[model samples]
Target: MPGTYPVPPGGGRGAGPATVPGDLLAELDRLLAPSVRSLRHSCAVDLTFGGSLAPGSRDAITIRHLDGHLGHTLRDLHVRAGYGLGGKVFSMGRPLVVRDYFNTAHIVHAYDRAVAPERIETVFAVPIRAGETVVGLLYLAQRDDVAIGDRIVARAVEHTRRIERDLAVGVEVRRRTAAYDEAATRDHRAVADARRDLDEAISLVGDPQARRRLREVSQRLHRITAGDDSAPQPAADGVLSARELDVLQLVATGAANGDIAAELGLRPNTVKAYLRSIARKLGATNRTHAVSLARESGLLP
Candidate 1:
């Protein structure tokens, strides 16, 4: 009996690094502590996870300040575009500071309700970018200071640099995960196509004996494509001959050159030739790519 495709057992897709960088947050607290050292002030960081604004808002100014306090809890109050401090920061990647809490022309008054309740005085906002992409903003506020100086702005930028590094790492991890997901999706589509071919073969063939054999082949192919059939199939790209396909299948299933040689009843040197030939036929630069393509094309399950 034909073996099933080796399905790497299903697990929920991993969301890369659920919690933000603890060390970075610690560093931020340490760095910002000096700025607000005299009177207790809070430092907050907020970001856009690409989708909609959580509750705090999407507009950068609102997201930076509002979410920092409430942690974006109120979906209804989410800042919209070009409305508040978050909006200004979103548009301008630089930092903005207001010494006196009550008066700032650089930003909108949309956050006045929340500010009035919080009794906020002075506010500073800075845009945090992952490279050129402005993902969110950072805000620091103090009720006493009417305006902050250059030193505080410099420290805030330094803090941003550290946080940006962490955010970049997170972005790279996400990119790799997305690439894997795309590859998996492509493999699934290929299997569906192969199954359709098998079904057509079984349906089109004539004679009871031939039809039974075809049906069996279809069932076996279905099992493999659906991840039930055991053993990986040979890699074929429509270019490889049947013998070449046989040679590659074993290679992909962790067979070494000599082991493939033994299985195919060919000399080790001959197996090497077959591998080279198969790679050329499949337009694969190396064995690994060849295997991946084979798997994706339903040449191997």
Candidate 2:
């Protein structure tokens, strides 16, 4: 509680206190070759999220690659625990190799469908890690009897390391940015509270002359709070009575009192009475000046 900072609504340590670093997911995807991208098109490599992972969840996953013009991405992932090739590598936190998945008696027989549809004769699954945690797994496979060499798996692991480093940097940037925004909001609120306290103290003075001076100061403060500027101005448009509007319109058009009375079917004295009321409401001088002031203040055309 000693160093607590007030955060604005929906703002915390993640809001870019500094400029956002580059997106790591896009960078990692770019490092992948076209062949890898095509193969991974079916894989569930979710790079669109940033946050802590759930207690028992890994960050990403891999699925088998299909051949021919199936022309569809992979869906319906079948996951197991240390069972099939992908599951074994995920649980052991080590790379797995199966030359012929159907013949692999050492690993569980689950995920047979994944291997069968892809015609996988040889496959490799390597777990991607952040520090000691296995964040995800990557799979490489060929449909025919060509052996998937160890070199390709090594290269994939190197890429994973690069992605992990970039991801850590981005996470740190987000955390620091959130902290700075929280501090700024705290400082602003403290300033606002201090101003409120000062206003309350100014209202509490008791001596007659002092009270009178304080009341004047309070009225000034109230004007500031209410956004009122003390200038000799017309009332806001539409604030005048119907008679006041008729008088103001005649004045705006430069009509004489006799002409206005004739136009409005009123006595000249009645017109004069409405004119005085309009002038008083608009804080204006006499007839000629009232018209000028009304036009200037936007109450009359």
Q: Where is model 1 poorest over a 10-residue stretch in terms of lDDT?
A: 1-10
lDDT of 1: 0.52
Worst 10 residues of 2 by lDDT: 1-10
lDDT of 1 by residue, 83-140 (tens): 5654555555455555554565556777677556445566665555544444444556
CA lDDT, candidate 2, residue 76:
35
Assess each prediction's global lDDT (C-alpha) against the native. Answer: 0.52, 0.52
| Model 2, TM vs. native | 0.47
How high is the lDDT of residue 214 in model 2?
41
Residues 92-130 of candidate 2: C-alpha lDDT, one tens digit per residue:
666656666577576787767644654556666655444
Off by over 4 Å in 1: 1-86, 104-110, 130-135, 146-155, 162-176, 199-220, 229-301
TM-score of each: 0.44, 0.47
